[model samples]
Target chain A: MAEENLKGLMLPVVIGKLLAPLPLFPLQFILSRMVRGIAQRRPEFFARLGSHIDSSYAIDVTELPFVLLLKPNPRNPELTAHRRPDKVASDASIAGPFMELFKVLDGRGDSDAMFFSGNLKVSGNTEAAVCLRYALDDLEGSVIEDLLHMGGPALMPAHLLLQRLRRLEMQA
Target chain B: MNTQAITPNAKPELVCPAGTPAALRAAVDSGADAVYCGLANETNARNFAGLNFTPDLLEQGIAYARGRGTKVLLAVNSFATAPRTQLWFDAVDTAARLGVDAVIVADIGVASYAAEHHPQLRLHLSVQAGASSPEAIRYYCSEFNVKRVVLPRILTVTEIAAIHREIPCEIEAFVFGNIGMMSEGRCSLTNYVTGTSTNMDGVCSPANAVHYMDLPDGSKTAGLGDFEIDCFAAGEHAGYPTICKGRYLSPVRKEPYYAFEEPVSLNLSSLLPDLIAAGVTALKIEGRQRSRSYVQAVVSAYRRAVDDIAAGRWHDLSGLVALTEGGKETQGAFQTKKWR
Candidate 1:
C-alpha cells in the first residue's frame, strides 16, 4: 500500500522531467533547417567559410546540449544536427553556453571580448577556428531573421513560443 | 636634485605594440616612433592563437615600418627551458638576419647567446627579466651589451630617476596598459592553476583552461581549472579571469574584493613629463593581444601627447579613458603607493 502511494506521488515529477526536454527536439530541428536554408541562400558566404576551414567543424551549445556539425564542401556546405552527445566530433570545435553563442551568431557580442573573458572556448585547429571567426564576422545577414522568413506565416507563433521559452530558461 | 633646465629637444621615443601585420601598419601610420612585435611562436610573450606575425609577415612588417621611418623591435621575450633553447636562439638569429632595430630578450641564456653570436644586433633587456635594481641592470649591460632596459612597472618616478643616474643603459618604462603587480618573469600563478608555465610556454591563464558559468540568479562565475576565480553580478562588466586580477572573499571583508590587482588599466599620461624628466628614453604602450583599431587609437593619442609635451603644451588625456580596461585607469605606483 505504501509503495503504491509513493509511486503515485512521484509520477508527476517523472512525467514533468520527461516532457521538459520534448520541446527541444522541434527547436533543434527548426534551427538546423534554418541554418541549411541560410547556407543554401548564401553559397558565397559558405564558400568563404570553406576557404578558412579545410575540414569538418562543430559548434556545440554547452548549455543547450546540442551540436551542429558543419562540413564545408566549398560549393554546398553540409550542416548536420547531432542531438546525441555521443555522436558529435569534428576537426575543430567552438563551444560556449547558448546565450553567448546566440549573441555571437546574432552579431550582438564581441568574439574577442567573449573569448578573453573565458565565456567562449575553442579546441582543435586554432587557425581554422580563427578563420571561422573571420568568416562569421563577414557574414552579411541575420540567420535568425532569415530562418523566420523561410518558416512562413504558420511558424511565427511557434517562433514566438520558442523565444518566450528561452526567456524563461534564462530567467530560471 | 638636478633641476636642470629642460633640453626642449629630448623627446622620448614612442614605442607601440603590434600583434598583427595590419596593426603594425596602423601603428606606423599613426606616428609610432617604433613598433614592437613577435613572431607567431612561443618566443614572444603575447603568444595567443591567431595573434603575432609570421616570419614572412615580420619581414614585410619590418620593411613597411622602415619605409615610414619607424623602427621595428622583435621580441623574443619568453624564457627558454634547457631543452627548448634552440627556438630562442633561432628567433634571435632570424631577427638579426631580418635587420630588426633591436631584439628584446629576457632569458639570461638567450641574452648571452645573442650577445656572443650577433654582436651588432642591439639588445634590449625585456621587462620579463625583472632587472629593477642598479646592480641587476649593470650586470645585464656589462655582460650582454644591453643598450636599454625596459624597467618593470614597480618603481616610482623618484626611484626611476635614481636608477637612471646609476645605470649605464637607457631606461625604457611602460607608459600605458596592463600593470603586472607581481615580479615579472617570476609569476607562477597561472602555472599553478593551469599547469602551463607563462615564462616557458608564453601563455598566462591560457584560454583553454578558462570557463565561464552563467548562474540562475543572473550572475556569472569565471573559473580557472577547478577554482572559481571571480563572480560578476548582473550588469557588471566581466574581466579576463587572470589569477592576479581575480576577486575573492576574505573572512574580514563583507564583500568580495580584488585580492591582488583590480581590472584597471595603467594610464601614465599625466606623469609623462615627470617620466621624461626622470630620463626614461622610451615609453612603451603594451597590448599585442589587442585589435588594430585599438592600436590606432592608442598610438594616435600617445603620439599627440608626446608631441605636445615636447612642445611644452598641456596634453589632453581625456580621450583615452574610453580605451582603458573596465573603463578605469590608474597611475599604478607612478603617482603613489597608497593604491595598495
Candidate 2:
C-alpha cells in the first residue's frame, strides 16, 4: 500500500517538475476552454452546489508552480491558471498535491481522509469547500477520469499507465 | 403487537445510508437490503448544507431503489420543536405519500403522528430515539407500532442479548461509523456552543458553524462556532469539531486530552457473529454525510461480509479502520463495556 501511494505520488510530482518552467499562456487557454466546456456539459452538477454555484475557488497544487482560480458560475464558468503567491480572490482555497485533489474530485479518494491526513488542506470558507466536495462527490461519473481521457491526448496517458502498473504490482 | 418475532432472522438486514439520490442508487446497486435517507430539512439528522434530498429527488430515489429490490427507509428522525411539529408531520406525510418501505423516527411525537396518520407506513425507531432497553422498546412498540428499535451504540453484546430476549420488537444495532457518548436526543454539548443539535435541528457542529484554520506556527485547528476545540500538528489526523468528539484543555490534565470523547469510529466487523448471537435483526452503517464512494465501499464490504458469514465463512475487515477518524477504530461498547 505504501509503495502504491509513493508511486501514485510520483507522476504528479514528476509532471509538476516537467511543467514548472513551461510558459503559462497555453495551459491557461486550455483550462478556460475546459472550464466552459464543463459548465456547458454539467450544468446540473454545478447547480447541485446550491448557493455556492457562483463561489470562487482556488485549486492550489502545492507541487506545481501555478494555481487554478475557478468560479462554477452556472451561466459563464471561469477557470484560469496563475502563478503561485500571486494571489487570486476566491471564496475558498483547497491546496494539495495534484493527484490527491484529482482523486478527491473523482471520488476515488475520501476527502475527509485526505483532509485529516493533511494531504488535502482547505482554507477560507470551509463550508463552501465542503459544499464543493459534496457536489463533486455526487457528480454522476468521475470528472477527473473524464478529464484524463480527454487529457490522454498525450502525456497523461503515459503517466496514468504507469500508475495502473504500480497498482498491479501492489496487488501482486 | 407485530413484534416481527423474536426468533431472529436467518440473516440480519444490512441497512445502508445515502445523503443524495446518487448515493441512494449506489447503495442499492452495492447490495444494500435497505437504504436510509432523509429530506433536505431539519427532519433529517444529517442536515448538512447541500446534502440530503429534496422531496422531488427523494421520490426519484425511492422509485429507483424500489425498482432494484432495495427497501428505502425515510428518516424523519430529528426532534420536532414546538410550533414546528407540523414540519415533522409533513415529512411523515411525504414519506407515506412517497411509498417508502419504513420511516425511521426519533421523536415520540413524530412516531405517534406517523402511527396515527400514516398507519400503513412501517416504523423503525431511529438510534437517536436511544431505545436501549426492553421497557423503552416495548413502549415504542405498544404506543407507536414501531416494528424495530435501533439500539443506542452504548450497549455491550451481552447487554443487547439480555435486552433482545425481553424486547418484543426487532433489534437494530449500529455496526459502523460515528459513536457518540450515547446521550442521544438529550445531549446539549454541541448546542452549548453551536445552538443546534442532532435531536432538535438534525445537525451537530453544523457546517456553517464549523471552521478549520491554520495557525502561524503551521498547526491546524478545528473550531465549532467560536471555540477552538482541537489543534493538530503536521501529519496529525484531524476530525470535525463535533463537540462530543473534540478534545479539550483541562487544568487537571497536563496537556490536552479527550475531555468528552476521542475521535474514533466504531467498526463491528469482527463482532458480526456476536451481534447475531445477541439477536441483532439488522446492522446499520451510520454515515449520511458521506459521498457515493463511501456508500458503495462500506455497503459493498458489509454486503460481502454478511453474505460470507451466512455461507459459513469469515474474512478480515480491519482494512476499513483506515476510513475512520484519526485512523482509529473501536468496538465501541459492543464487545466491552468501555466507551466515553
State which candidate has the highest lDDT: 2
Candidate 2 lDDT, A72-117, residue by residue in tens:
8878788988987797899899998776676665556677777878
Could you give candidate 1's per-residue lDDT for residues B1-340 as a string of tens digits? 2223346557899999987776788899999999999986789888765567767878999999999999999999999998889999999999999999999999999999999999999999999999999999999999999999999888898999999999999999998888876588899999999898889888787756776666788677888888899997766667667899899999999999999889899999988889998999999999887656677889999999888888777778788877777778999887776767
Write out the backbone clash pairs for model 1.
none
lDDT of 2 by residue, B49-142 (tens): 7788888988999889888898999999999989999999999999999999999999989999999998999999988888877888999999
Q: Which stretches of candidate 1 lie over 4 Å from their true place?
A: A1-172, B1-9
Off by over 4 Å in 2: A1-10, A17-25, A145-172, B1-8
Compared to the true structure, candidate 2 yields what TM-score?
A: 0.91
Error of 2 at B247 (Å): 1.6
* Residue A164 local lDDT, model 1: 51
Q: How does each model score on lDDT?
A: 0.79, 0.83
RMSD in Å for all candidates: 10.7, 4.0
Task: Tell me, by TM-score, which candidate is best.
Answer: 2
